[model samples]
Target: MPPINVIRNALVAGSAERRPAVLWALASLALSMLLSSLGTSIANVGLPTLAQAFSASFQEVQWVVLAYLLAITTLIVGVGRIGDIIGRRRLLLAGIVLFSVASLLCGVASTLGQLIAARAAQGCGAAIMIALSMALVGEAVPQARTGSAMGLLGTMSAIGTALGPSLGGVLIAGFGWRAIFLVNVPLGLLTFLLARRHLPVDRRGPQTERAGFDTLGMLLLALTLAAYALAMTMARSHFGPLNIALLLAAAIGAGLFVRVEVRATAPLIDLAIFRDPGLRAGLAMSALVATVIMTTLVVGPFYLARALGLDAPFVGLAMSAGPLAAALSGVPAGRSVDRFGAPRMTIVGLIGVAAGSCMLSVLPTRLGISGYLAPMIVITASYALFQTANNSAVMTATRPAQRGVNSGMLGLARNLGLITGASVLGAVFALAAATPDIATAPPEAIARGMRITFAVAALLAAIALTIAVASRAVATRPVRDEFSVGK
Candidate 1:
């Protein structure tokens, strides 16, 4: 329980000026989002260094990335519901504190095991922020401005991903890899202070005396996702009996999780949402887009640096073009979604994404930096359009009571895409790397493999587009209230 003074302060603060709340909320939430995005890119720059430092295989060190994604993805639904059970602000505060502490620990970690553990903790903190920030912003802001505000939030997120590699590289060069984690400290402290001062404290109903948490379900879900991620990550090297066993175990656990959700008194995942066609389409598209996006993210860097022989930082810069375009395009896309129904935006965005993927698939291997940059711009713009429409579609279709659950599910879909993207693309790269005539194989052979992956991603995007089109058969209700932007 919070101290008396803290309760008193919240009451007083809640009644104070509204601008402070917006500022406080945005500051903390934006930086938190930034940190999460940064985490994804920061580790890539240090892959070589960590390999040398720990004398570990590349596949082993890759868990630094895989673990964080798995932890955050699996926990999103459970954590989102937990925030509803407790309070969004309280969870946000706790999450930020934990994230900062974890980051600090990550900076000082002495072993690969410790770093992986710290990253998982960091991911936990990240889930809290991602889960609550949308609802918090929706609660605080009016309808008219919500689109712009959420658009701005999306923009900042893209920028964070854009900056991560460059920032990580600079920090690693100047002060070792640890600085990437340490950089979050000051920003986190400021966010915490500001959020505590201004975020509204809305007590929904009387707190339950003995509310039960779905601990078993959460553990089962986590273990299932962990096993799946482990199996995928391991598929690149040796597909041994052990990995096959893990994959089978994961499938069984997933089945059990579904059963638990169906029967639980207050299930962690609200399975009823799956019954809604709009939500089903939105979530399906979300997952497909996620896979496409993640696949491109992993393959783009490798193609540029390894196949094209670009420098590390330059590869980061080349990669930033996609995110930069997405950042620039997000707000306009959001406004477009507000004025028009999501179908047009959805169709256009999906088409653009598929078209861009197709364009990337055929790019000549002999092309230079400009060749790389062109494809990125198309992909990013398409992403921006898809994300804006997808978010609006999910929130608009969901009832206020179920928004948190829907959002968490959307996050899960996206993360699942990321996991599959990493796995499938890793497999593609593995296949390429395994070619027998590698020493004499044409430089374009690697490029050809990348094209194959892009083609797969394009197909996924096209399927999502098809689903979005089919969703129109049932006819979605046009969203009237603009105030529920982040709902």
Candidate 2:
């Protein structure tokens, strides 16, 4: 027997022995979440600087971020499936190592293409880190405590987001953009070491029961997401054969992926999960919430910098408000979800988001930092409320054996929303202002574009609110002892 298996058996047989392992595993996972979340937000703050440094057009430079997102979105489900077959602990450790190396490469890249490639590699690692983090938390913590555990994890994510921009600003201003990536190296190394030492061994499914990897499904899914992202991102570019080709490919890929998933013995994503209305509604709302959050992330900075004439530090400070609000609200929201159930909280939270969006859409153009702060706080606080409750709802509805893939699906929805939000909201801004690049567009044009984008986001929030209103409530289920080894 493997050493990890021995450890797992010993820990499972002794309740006192399990506590330290659980704490260590949870702590490691929380740190991993924080590190990965920090990387997600930090890159956004450097977009303008990167464009300037590379002398690349905004459309060209946007690929730096888009490439990362696309890679994660395309591969996360497949990676999550792999985690169940092998072990999440092993995969997570490998992911940390890969992320660290990719960060080093990104910091040293001399060209835009090299940076973009490195960022994609980083995203690949990020997919593993993200897909398994929540699943691992679920496996390690008791069912009764799962809500609070998830809340703490959510708070860590919010803290990372809260710190990212301000940290990015200080790093970029003092040390240059490379510091943002280089800094990850040391942190990644630490996380990798801790994860290797502390993360629990996987011993869930029998080896004979695990199916072969769905290679074809993964390929089709990748093509579908990549082509769709390209089509959306390049919609503002002059019409061309290449653009039309991408759209056609996306359409074909989507049709084929669905067909393959429906027929496969073990699909990359199990389509059957959607049959549960509560899970379905939770996922739908998750995507929309992420869309609203990312739209602000992608669009708000430009508006603040251009229309309000703030510098990187000031812009970073203003942007920090949202995540700070999210961090502050995450725990309370999670407790609320535990006590009151997810459905009611989701409805209330969605309303808050819609109201915040409306406020942002109508705010005056020249109110300085204070004006942006209030709307941002409101939007993000609502996001915290929605996300904590909605996530609890989704997890409660899913079976223990399906946690890895389900968590992957949840992440997939988020990244997909992010991809769509960045592309659609960006396109809206561009078309509204009649410009290809908001970075260089006139302040009035940016202001007009921002308003339109926020209004659209508000509409999206309303749609999610409607879905939550009609969805079934999630019932709290007892944790199965067979699946509760760590707990």
Q: Report the C-alpha lDDT of model 1 over 179-289, residue by residue, as the tens digit.
A: 988998887887788778777785674445125677888899888978887787676556789789989999999999999988887777768867778888988998898
- Tens-place lDDT digits, model 2, residues 1-487: 3212322322232268676777667667777778878878788779999999999988788888877778888888778878877777788888889989999999999999999999999999988888888878767776655655666678778888777777887899999999999999998988887788877677757755477888999899888888977776676555478878998999999999999999998787788877888878877888888888888988888888898888977877777788888887776777776667777788888999999998888874656566677888889988888887787777766776677777888888987787678777777877887777777999899889888889999999999998887774233222354358656
Task: Tell me the lDDT of model 1 at 134.
Answer: 66
TM-score of each: 0.87, 0.85
Error of 1 at 457 (Å): 1.6
Model 1 lDDT-worst window of ten? 1-10
Return the clash pairs for model 1, or none.
Answer: 143-482, 143-483
The candidate 2 region of ten consecutive residues with least summed lDDT is 2-11
* CA RMSD of all predictions: 6.7, 7.0
Q: Count clashes in each candidate, considering only residues at least 3 apart in sequence or on different chains.
A: 2, 0
